[model samples]
Target: MRSDQPNYDVDPTILQPPGTPVWVADEAWRELARAAARLDRAVVVVDCYPGVDEQAVKASLERVFDVVVSVPDEAARPTEEIDALVAANLGDDRVFGYITQFNVADLYDEARLAELRRRVHERTGPIVLMGWGARLAAPDADVLVLADMPRWEHQLRMRAGMPNWRCKNGDEDILRKYKRSFFVEWRMADRHKQPLLDALDYLLDTTISADEARLITGDTFRSALDAAITRPFRFVPYFDPGVWGGHWMQEVLGLPGDVPNYAWGFDCVPEENSLALDIDGVRVEMPSQNLVLRKPIELMGPGTFARFGADFPIRFDFLDTFGGGNLSLQVHPLTGYIQEKFGMKYTQDESYYLLDVGDDGGVYLGRKPGADFDEMFDELEKAQRGEGSFPDERFINRFNARKHDHVLIPAGTVHCSTRNTMVLEISATSYIFTFKMWDWDRVGLDGKPRPVHLDHARANVQWDRDTDWVTSNLINRIDVLEQGDGYRIERTGLHELEYIETVRHWFSVPTLRDTQSTVHVLNLVEGRAAVVESPTGAFEPYEVHYAETFIVPAHVGEYTIRPADGAGECATLTAHVRGTEFPRSVSGEDLRFSGRSAS
Candidate 1:
């Protein structure tokens, strides 16, 4: 409803016209204005996370409406009973307005929902059904609004004792408790709401003040999505402290010095990372998966989208061990193993691109020459039971690591990044399937031994990948493909893996290229920064800094890259799905070593 005093601090361009019914999915802190001039009857139904301020919302609604009714005075009644009670109150002369709690658990009852909507449709005045599931329940709503906050911000609020519907005990582990109880529900709600975005009238960034809930219209939302896909975007990086965490991120990434140590930085992981959007000098964050969900074919090429659907098939992250300890010796399940056991479509075929390394930096990769698999298994079992110690040096081979060295790690390979090194991990989207085999007989940061997965490791380990074979086949195999004035292109990756391909471009002058309907994930490995611009001046130029990762959307077709104004020559690693072409340097002999026939 209209308000002469400016009911909301929203961008005027994105606000709905007067008399539009809006369904707002919002944070507890923000509420619809109580005293709008146009609303003769207004209702606010709130079934929110445990810690929201329900009383404030009720108070706000009462200030404007002629009458306000809170249905089902008993909060624990069944949905059918609650609906009957609400229906019974509709004829009350004073019940011109209704504020009812719409619970997530009630979404399963389609028949009950249809009946409830039919009853509401018979009413005569304006109605505002505002809550978590209100939009889903009322599909014919005039406007849909999503009120969101970044996960980290929500965690901070939860830690500060924000009213939560799930957590009542006020435990010290409230964040963990809240996530355990409601994360799945939140994810489901997010997925269900994404398809309705085209009908969204306004997206309120509730992280801001109520007066400034950044309003984004449906058209603006579409524009932002297009810009997000075509431009160099950054996901909000999340950091974690682990027992084996190191100081590199704290020093290099200049993270807050308060954390004990930084172990991993999720840079572009859509499953866990949130995209930060700067809109009109205000910041708004949403799950990164929303981009892929909104424009699959535009973000990922048509071919890739056809193959993977809405999945963003690649992941990039940082593993910081500089001035710390080694990672546990681990193996990832093979493609078939993961599909059968984990119900996943793909396996984790990863690589380690060393960003920085100390003098003793090295990677524990493959098995030692002449390693006895049966003996190793016996030793592993004994170590697990505290009956014997692991002979680390005698069973695994260690390869010295240098800055910018690329180490390929196909599924089933045993590997770990050693201490005093920072690794830029590039891999398939399937993560969290690691099988730790050894941990140097050391305990975790909690002073307890970490659980090991020896059986799983043994089941997937490739016994044929010994020191000699790994050194000859998995090590850096770079071959110059083409050279020009002040520029060169080289093929560099685990080409025999048959999943994804990587190439490097070293150039000082401007270069133009097309994506060819294939998405490319790139990192400027060896320059201060570079400017990526539309070849036809269609969009703004995107400036990417050194060590920064960005994506080239499949639909962009062609783009140009040049050294940032004052920077020198630049080297960028470009990664994409390997459709059909095979590297020319990988001989049939190398393919045999990898146990794969040449294509």
Candidate 2:
């Protein structure tokens, strides 16, 4: 029999609605029908997230309204113009692109927009305007219905021969389509959507299927968003396989066996993760970021929202190479380099916390002290040119990893998590700015060579951070700040350069924690299950399992973490913005984040 003792949760949800307010199937259509009774010549706009099936919407609208106008057909920019607009961000390569500064409204024709506006006004019947950014077509529509879907759903649609918004390239490469979405379409769409989502009249969910749509009133949606920030919750985690993917997640996480392996488990990357709502027992899914967008002050705190502006500044994900191959050696750009090169606000500064590792293998990190740089770059370029494999051992330092060992990697530091290790990667939320210098001479799962940005790596690598620096500062620099009645707190190294501060707690009994005005993301790294509860019952008691990540809202103020009833010793790793002081290793009340943070 296949093994089935895995405890990974695949469908974690947040925000349980109070009543059965959702309308489904024909009831959804009837709700729209009642809204457009042709009594007063009303206009309803179904503004959509890109990749939504316009035809499905048109059919649904045609069933309810006498006049249905597709906003995309009315004002979408010409195909040639769209290609020219996104060309810079859609660089010649496949897996990379700079973030686009354009907006979805910029993809409209002003002349056509005016004409459509006139036509809608001239109509004497209940009219429906629909498409991506459809409200841009009729700004003062009587009722606003926002059709939204998760990014993962959009990726699935892309694989199903759907084109990028306003383009006719359905048969194009999937990677290119994703690149378009990542660097261009999504950025533009999100910018257009945030304000609209803030005041939407209705929130529509069509991710389950086109034929069966779920509809909820905007009031209920807002209630759900409000409820989300009062407690700790988990986002739906999505898993994917890659060239260096391994079977650990598939076996340990109880994933479907259809994929070859599970390489990445996006546990806390909300931008791509789904947040499920338990709406009267019928689970509905939406992008987790909507919570971040609609309730930043409550969820992320005022200081954090003011600093990052609705973006979830911290990220937690898994990189499993156990029973597989090495991850590509890479470097992240410095803040100035990323800002100047990619139009981004910040750079990725990360740490790899080893969850599991074998004795013979470790992580490749930093470089040998005083290595010949000219020769290393030349060799990498030659490897990119197919001359030979980049000789990693000649220049890079390999540090042996162990269970619960944390490795801090600042921007421009060369590093990679090698085979036979399960890594929980905690970092700043700039998720996709890695500059790959080498890939161990292998193609991707698509059987094509992975893109290596040797030039970018050369421009940013910190030559001074050699073996000595990494050993002294990055590897396993844990400071035991305090031991208390039933717990001890340890400050894990994330280096001074990184904005995220990580702390570990080992507890056999309940441990008290205060939010300290910053959001805390924690993982049950060494326990079967742990319980998170409010001191005064401010929130429901939340249960978390091993390798599971949950968020404590910045305003939670005070909470407690302990092993689920009768469970044994447990450990957790918590990450928050660096705002508290780090105290020297000591006894008594000097615990990192004990009463304060473990600084």
Candidate 1 residue pairs in backbone clash:
49-165, 50-163, 50-164, 50-165, 51-163, 51-164, 52-163
Instruction: State TM-scores per candidate.
Output: 0.77, 0.95
lDDT by candidate, in order shown: 0.64, 0.85
For TM-score, the strongest prediction is: 2
Query: Which residues of candidate 2, in runs, are more than 4 Å off?
Result: 1-4, 580-592, 595-599
lDDT of 1 by residue, 1-599 (tens): 00112111111111222433322334212334432223443333332222223344345445544433332122234545534544422232211112222335443456655565664566566455554555544566544455444554555566676633333435434533344323333444545566666666555555534433454555666667777666555566677777678987676555678988888877767755666555444455555666787888888887787778787888888888877788988998898887765446788898998888887898988999888999998988888888877888889999998888988899988999998888889899875678888887778665767768787788999999999888887878787777778778777786486477888888888876556677878877777778888857876877777767778877776677788887898888888777722222233232101211111
Backbone collisions counted per model: 7, 7
- Model 2 scores a TM of 0.95
